[model samples]
Target: MPSSLMLSFLFFLLSLSACSLKTQTTEPEKISHINKENYMIPGINHGLIQSPINILSNEKHETKNHQITLHFQDEIKAVENLGHTVQLDFSKGSSISSDGINYEFKQMHFHTPSEHLIDGMTFPMEMHIVNYAPPATKNGIPHYLVIAVLFKMGNENEFISEFLTLIPKQSNNTVKLEKGRVKLHDLFHDDLSNEMKNYYHYRGSLTTPPYTETVNWFVLKHIIEASPEQIRAINDIEGDNARHIQTIYGRHID
Candidate 1:
């Protein structure tokens, strides 16, 4: 071959090698950016008081001047099978008054492998009893009082058993229950006041998207019990939906 032709061939090979190397190096960075974008919104998912934080059991908490009263009806209307979680909707008229602010019972949902950690310990399941108070103003931030109950694998939990089989098989489906078919009182053995006496209280954001930072979290100190089979059944439907723990940011846990 002529020298000029040989030189041209060598240049072409070099150019191809460089292009391959560039793709190999840059592809991962591009993919990583997309993954981050999908997982987190710039300002929405981040905040100083984000949820699912590790609750240090030994940490000292300041006593706050607050009073809480529960006017619960324990009337669950329906169960919904969202793709990401199993949720039970509550009937209206049940409300909790905390510091003169009233928050009504809305719904309860579950997360597998838990979200919040107690002394860095992860439970098999976690349930959130979400209550909400509408904002006073048009654009004000809404208020939330979330009661979190962590569950360990032990004897079967009556609360979970009530609606476990009743959950709709398909995602986004809801099954309306007969009156008194499923009761939250059964979970506490009809002793909700005694069961709810002790808790770890804090302020945090919702674990899911639009993680509004106005949540008043009351994590029940008493860990509940559920059978391994029951936990597996719920986990199978929801998969691993627990969010990663966020920084505590020196927040108070009372």
Candidate 2:
């Protein structure tokens, strides 16, 4: 039998070895470096502002409903430095999945001076209504859905007048605005044509700093009409609020 000192020495060695192994195992994996040119976009430059793009088509498109409704309450006011983001309690503005899947509307926000360019044209503003699905599906899958709407110049944008009135005129990034219920019908126009129903959809990351790639983008084919005054009103309220567009990264535009 080994002497007591030798036995103690061996035990110490084993314990040291075990500690080394544990340290190696606990080290976190290195984060992969991402190239900004390959993933980021530098949005509109600080140049003299140009007049609104007058591009339009006589083409009409059929419209469909996603069954979303939102009610603004006293508690849904704006927050500071965060722009205007309203959180709907429960599934207030969410879409119901008949496929036995449940989803909830987390919140809604906007991007001024446009984010997504359609056919090489940028709109005055864009809004994103974010939704999160329930737990994993039967196939062990979970997903998020984001509906994006582009606002342009036109007189038919009266639907947004009430909402716009809540925007604060100060240069502060965030502010508290009155809460009101905004129904799905309030945002969507029913006079769209069949041709306008087609949209450009693809996997994309959020258009903000620390841009996350967890959004399922559904961009409408037809741009919603907003008066030039409406566009200026929002811009005046939230100057340079939009983030730069990110690279498509060979990502398929479905």
TM of each candidate vs. truth: 0.81, 0.55
CA lDDT, candidate 1, residue 190: 47
- Expressed as tens digits, the lDDT of each residue in 14-66 for candidate 2 is 99999988755431111112322343335732211111122222212223343
What's the alpha carbon RMSD for model 2? 15.2
Residue pairs in steric clash, candidate 1? Answer: none
Worst 10 residues of 1 by lDDT: 27-36
* Models, CA RMSD each: 13.9, 15.2
lDDT of 1 at 162: 85
Cα lDDT computed for each candidate against the true fold:
0.85, 0.51
- Stretches of candidate 2 exceeding 4 Å from the true structure: 1-81, 84-93, 96-102, 134-143, 168-181, 191-197
Residues 164-230 of candidate 1 have per-residue lDDT tens digits of 9989989999999888989988776746656666888887889998887778888889888999999
